[model samples]
Target: SASETPGKAAVGEENIVKLQHVQDTREFFIEVLEYLPGGNLYQYLEQKEMLDEYTACRVSLRILKALDHLHARRLLHRDVRLQQFILAEPGDPESCKLADLWCLASLPRKKNFMVEEGRPCDLLTAAPEVVKQGEFSAKSDVWAAGCVIFELLHGHPPFGGTGKALVQRICCGEPEFSELGTATGGLSDNAIDLLRWMLQREPGQRPSVHECLKHAWFEGYNVEKPSKQVWQVEKLIRHVKLWGKPPHSRRNLPASNLLASKRGIVTPGFCTYMGATSVDIDFEPCQMCQGVLEVIGKSEEQQSLGSRVWYWVTKCVLSLWGREENPKQIQLKVCVKPGSPWVELGSCTLDDSTALEASIKIDKPIRYVRISLRGNLGGHFGIAVRKVAFYGYQVRQIPIALHLENLKFLRGSRLHTHAQDIHPKEVNARVHKSLQSSLRVGRRIEGTGAKYRVYEDICSGSPHITTAAETPRLKFPQGVVLIGAVLGLRYVSEVPSKESAPPRLRIQIVKEVNAGGDHERRMKKTLLFATEDLTPPSWKANEVLGNGYVDYPVMFSTGIRANGDDRLHLEILFQNFSGTAHVPADLGLSFFYVPELQSPSTSEDEGLWAGCIQSVQSATVESVSLGMRKLLSIWFPFHFPRSFPCDFLLLRFYILQPYILVSLT
Candidate 1:
């Protein structure tokens, strides 16, 4: 029913004829295959409204079988639209044959064809990867089949829009189902599912045409017989009815606007052609635009709902292989219109050794264009345009902690002592006075005249010394002495002996104040001491009166005495601290060993018997003023195990004043 005539003026004098390639295709069919011409299914559907299920199935099977044959022969009918099929006889539907080989491109002779990735194309009926990457195989044809099915079921394509918008929707939006549902009175789920499978994004997921024949929707379909002859005749009639009329005359229009004569302008019409030089032309303009000209490239000629168009421009260059001279430059001016923004859009200047590219966008449409070379040109360099499309933007999310400042070790001694003790006198003067006055006043008013007050106390004592008897057993009468200042006690011991014992000592602090007639009482106890030896012993205090200062010393002397001793050894160790902060107390203690008088019988000996204090120090026991409270226990060992007879061991303790304090932020 449909036939094509090229170079003949049957329709109109100015009617555009099919390109030579298309004409050759028609010749191959008519002369070689002896088949009459046929047209597209679009016209057929327009006239009949819709095809019966059996006819639809027959048509689908025929198309698929034909596609399989083409693919097997390594031939690709790139434009697989419904408009390509044609009818052979005027009224015989069974005479319908495949037509419009204009868009067909000979595939590579070898099995391998260079496939580019992420090439943009028509999106509506195109596979996802085809739109993303310009990579395709025979499976791509199956995707076209899905589109064809969609059109058959409905009146229109799945996704329909302008060039850019169509591409956008195809790449980003889902296909419309409402139209198909309405046209077919609701398609079977199996049919819908088959269509979806055929249109999957991945090419490998699409079923082959042969495989499609097995689908449930195509059940009982016949691929050999022309059972849908009436449908084919109707389709041919529709085509003749629609496009059979002569093409519209453009003679009344401006001669300059004619498509053949127009330069740098694409008319608002559809044009399909086959072969490489389908629409090639050259132009020489009097003046050139200062801006850059952008040209888009098309992978295929058929326009689908969503297809991206890419464009590029280049300059011509020439070089001699054996010559080592400088290359000449060509000056070229190009202009691009303001239109839709394009990704990977930019300008480039081509020289002998370098090429540059940039991305750009246009806001308005443009028609007339010109380009000028910057310098003398050896060859021509021009801009090329094509559609480059992509699917979607790749997106990738990445947790983040803030605020940390300082850290320090807590040791109490300025010297070797582990426990630091705070003396009653070192307490915050204000707090000390207030506490002392309160106690003094309270005690005085009560008529109980207490000389000192007990405020805060802590004990740091050794557990090794168990009994009072063992307390003085390890004491050094006239040698080095060890003291625990924080514990407010000294370990009294001498050279090991059968009767030597651990020290039995306790710490007590006294603060004297004038009572007067107010009869007030003030009490403050800063340090406390504990002894492993719990038994009570006779308390003896030795006072060293010097320069109007009274120093009281408690000595736990071992009964054993040594003679001719020249040196003394002392060792000290600290355990742990334990205490409370009600009353601020700090204890500091020192030890001294005195040598006993030499016997008159040995007076002739040159050795001297004397007591010496080699060092002094202080440590922290507790500091109530700084909110730091601790108990420190220390152990001290002294030995003067020589044969020299020693007289006495002197132990001294002092209270240090509190100084620097730290506060939290």
Candidate 2:
């Protein structure tokens, strides 16, 4: 009201008169009004030390009757406050009338746009919808009436603070009268109960103004006209000035003095919200120093504004290391920007409204952050933000590593063949037989000296020197030497050397002559030679004399005759041979030998008869050593008639020489 006329202005004058303009609908005050003047109730409340219970009830009843009449006429007073009430006469306790028609809007005017542009109405006396959604109805006015009653009893507005804070408190919930202490004393129980019901969450739940008038708190109160007397406005103004402004102004002045004047300490911070009745704050563990700071709000409950809540903190940081300079305190202020998406989770704001925060520990430090909404905001509409900062320490980084292992080598022999004798005794006997018989018969065998012979004619060249009647009766030497080992060797013997009287032995490899004719025969008359030593002493025979003469005649035989008692060592080697193109189905070793037997007749009467024959002893030698080339042949179940190279050598006395081999069949 002071700002409307323009003067030095009260502390909150600019905020009190901000108005909105709409389509004009003028009504003559004198024609519609029934009462004269009561002056402003807000100013009257300030001047009076206190109102008695009976007086407060009487005043509340008049306001209710007026509102009931307005509701019946379908007129809504969108703006109602202590300032709108006037006195009918000076010093008249019960004469009051509602004023300020500027904020009124018609019921049939579908859009009540006038209310938005009227005066900067007191939020403490406004309804929840007016603060939250800017919607107003007759029920909203009832809520305003409840606030006026609270103010009348308390000597101040029900929830008073920054206009924003009061709005937030009203939207959230009504302020408790019990928190007003002595200011709320002497109020009738029915009066307090009706006030609370008017502030119910749903507008439809609130009682009509006519129903409020019938409340028990107004039992003895009358709505009839009282005496009208002209009141002097200057005298009332003097009375109001003597009582001073609202208690909030007086209480806040001392705090303002301390903050404005204190040099060394950082001043405590404050915040305001749109629809809240209180501004709750916690300043314990002061943001700046170790000392605690005090917090004040519009209501003792510390209500906050329902829109655009503000947060503030004070702190000091040492900028230099060694300089003893005055502590520099700075104020950090942040507004809770309100929106649906930013509902309060938790915050340092003591009222626990828009200021939201939950205990969150970022395990790792981060930078350049952008936070998006994660959950609901407790059924409210807009988002709100105040301030955020990390307090204690700095952040850091870390590192990593790895390892491995290695590799290594593996171990294995190649394949070979060595000669193993299958029938040594038979082989020795065979050698002796061939040597002795070949010496006695002196015939040429087909395989004895020939390099190669046709398959069918193997035994053809052998001397048919003796039939069964002319078979050899020979005396063999006691020992024989085999100089070379050869596969297919069958028989051998020792005989006298022509060069001297001592016996000479010859070692021989022999195969039996098969009886079948050309078509059935498979043997070839070829002796495979492993060596070329044809000298005489190299040929030798086994020591068994009877075994040497037992078989049919040996084809070739030779021996060595040296000094007395001189021994000779014989070495022999054998290998199997076959044509490369024809791999025989079966191959084996054969040994030819002779056996000694008694004469068939009694000796004295008939000439002594020596009957002899060649016999074969089974021999199988898998490994054999050829002269220079190693060849392996199978020699197990059956004998394979094949030729291979042969050699013989005699070692006697101090001399070592190649033993001559005499060819035999």
List the candidates' TM-scores in order. Answer: 0.28, 0.30
Model 2 CA deviation exceeding 4 Å by range: 1-38, 109-120, 180-184, 220-665
TM-score of 1: 0.28
Q: For residues 1-665, could you state the per-residue lDDT of candidate 2 as single tens digits?
A: 31122111111211122223223234422213334555677667666633555677788877777676667666677767777777767655467766655555556556423335344555767777777667778888998988887766655555555545555666674565642232223344666777778778678898889888778777753334233221111100001011111112222222122111111122222112232222222111111211111122222211111011111111111111111111111222111111101112122212233333322222111111112222123323212222222221110000000000000001011112111221333334443332322122112445454222111000111111110110111112222112111122222322234442221123222222445775553422223223221222233332222232111111211121211112221112211111011001111111111111111100011111111111212221212112211111111111111111110111110001112111112
Candidate with top lDDT is 2
Candidate 1 per-residue lDDT, tens place, 1-665, comes to: 12233212111211111223223353454312234544447667666444544455567666777677666555555556666655554533334455544334445667523365644344556655566666566677788777877766544566666666766766776676632342223345666777778777666777887788788877643333232110100010010011112222223222122122111122332111211111211111111111111112311211110011111111111112211111222222222111111112123344443222211222111111221212211322222111111111100000000000011113232221212232334334323221232111111213434332222221222222211110111222232222212122221121123344323334332233345556774543223233443221222111100011111122222221222132222222221111110111112222212212121001011112111212212233333222212111111111111100111112222121121111110
lDDT of model 2, residue 295: 20
Q: How many clashes does each candidate structure show, in the order listed? A: 110, 92
